[model samples]
Target: MTTGRAAQARRAADALRQRIVAGEFANGRLPDEQALGRSLDTSRNVVREALNLLRDENLVTRRRGIGTLVTAHTYRHGLDRLAGLAEELTPYGTVSNEVREARVVPHAPPAITRRLDIPERSEAVYIERLRWLDGGPLSLDSTWLAPDIGHPLLHRDLAGRDLFALIEEVTGAALGSAEVTVHAVTAEPDTARVLDVAYGAALFAIDRLTRLPDGRPVDVESLRVRADRFALRAVLPRS
Candidate 1:
């Protein structure tokens, strides 16, 4: 496809993806390509390409005469706002955590140290968890927290609470802000086994640095989220 047509297809796919997430498609079926093309003000070929894109993402399936079928996941996590996994997924279903590892590390790696803005030799608390939504694994999170804020969590219920809430409760300070960077990464062998996806499957990798209201960095987290089970959303303003 030409660059212009490719762009149009992407735009069309994005629109349809949002509609699918919003439950706009009745009975999980989309309108015919010609009808979609008319509604989206694009060509039938463009709509076909758009549907193909969604199919590649495993969000839809095209049948010979039955039309397009929506199989997209129901949860849309907002990228514009900072919230815990449990908090964001609350509207959909119960979010639970299986704490894999939680302990105080005497020395964190250089990369983690830099993200938390701590000395290379500084002690940090490390917590690894597999987050589940309604009994299915959704994300695998590896978090490193500055000693001060994370020490109290050593004995707390890590599996039953949101990490952000735990941090605030432990420190008695509200979380101020967070810097998040999200990108796609292929699942490695260990990660794939943990999340139950095929090796080399695409996954969403989010690296976040969260801070206290006073600007002191407290937490740095790396999360691998299942692409097939979640969608990222954001509203941008043109100013």
Candidate 2:
């Protein structure tokens, strides 16, 4: 049998989640427990439990005596399919570009070397950009491609272009699959400057390695996005 407090907690949590999705609560605002409890006709204990659920999901945070605040949404992409930056930002009407630093660079990092299967100290094309949404900075992206497959890319106009499409067109390498990982991070000074946010601001960092149909590594992209602007959702297959 379900206890009254547990039921109340579930109801309050669901109600609060709906309110958040509906934009009624507004981001970063802290509503008092008493007010939330009254709104849901429940006790403060139930409200607290509900808020704790949100905090666990990375949707909210509680400070010492500062109440609970809404955190930004983080987007998650499936490992089964490959997507471009533009496609990822479509829902938000976010605009992005290949910054001036998008060029071939030598001596790739160890992580990049391993992902792209390149020799240590090998040259690679480095693409850098600042993504914007409704004219506001959204993310800072840096991608590395093996020189053997990236040299020809330099001849093309990449500004405001999608790197994935460019790779397909140039190499005729159809994207088959990708491995991606997402994590929370604090922005560094350079990343902060490009994203137009303060240093140490919360960020959602994504690291992805894409492969061709034959399983050859094609590109490795590192994406750093503002925690507040992006949200990730997924539908899983039940076995």
- TM-score for each prediction? 0.85, 0.71
Tens digits of per-residue lDDT for model 2 on 1-239?
Answer: 65788777877888887676545765567589999988888899999999987776556889987888876543433334578767766675656574757667778888788889888888889987777666777778888998977888777767666788888988876687888898999989988887876788788898889898888897998899786556555566899
Q: Ten consecutive residues with minimal summed lDDT in candidate 1?
A: 71-80
Candidate 1, lDDT over the whole model: 0.90
Model 1: residue 116 alpha-carbon error in angstroms: 2.4
Highest lDDT: which candidate?
Answer: 1
Candidate 1 ranges beyond 4 A from true positions: 1-11, 41-46, 63-67, 236-239
Give the range of the ten consecutive residues with the poorest summed lDDT in model 2: 72-81
lDDT tens readout by residue for model 1, 1-239: 45798999999999998888877885889999999999999999999999999988778999997889886456888988789878999888888999999999998889888888889888999999999988888899999999888899988999999999999899887899999999999999999999988899889999999989888899999999988778788998989
Q: Which of the numbered candidates is closest to the native, going by highest TM-score?
A: 1
Candidate 1: residue pairs that collide = none
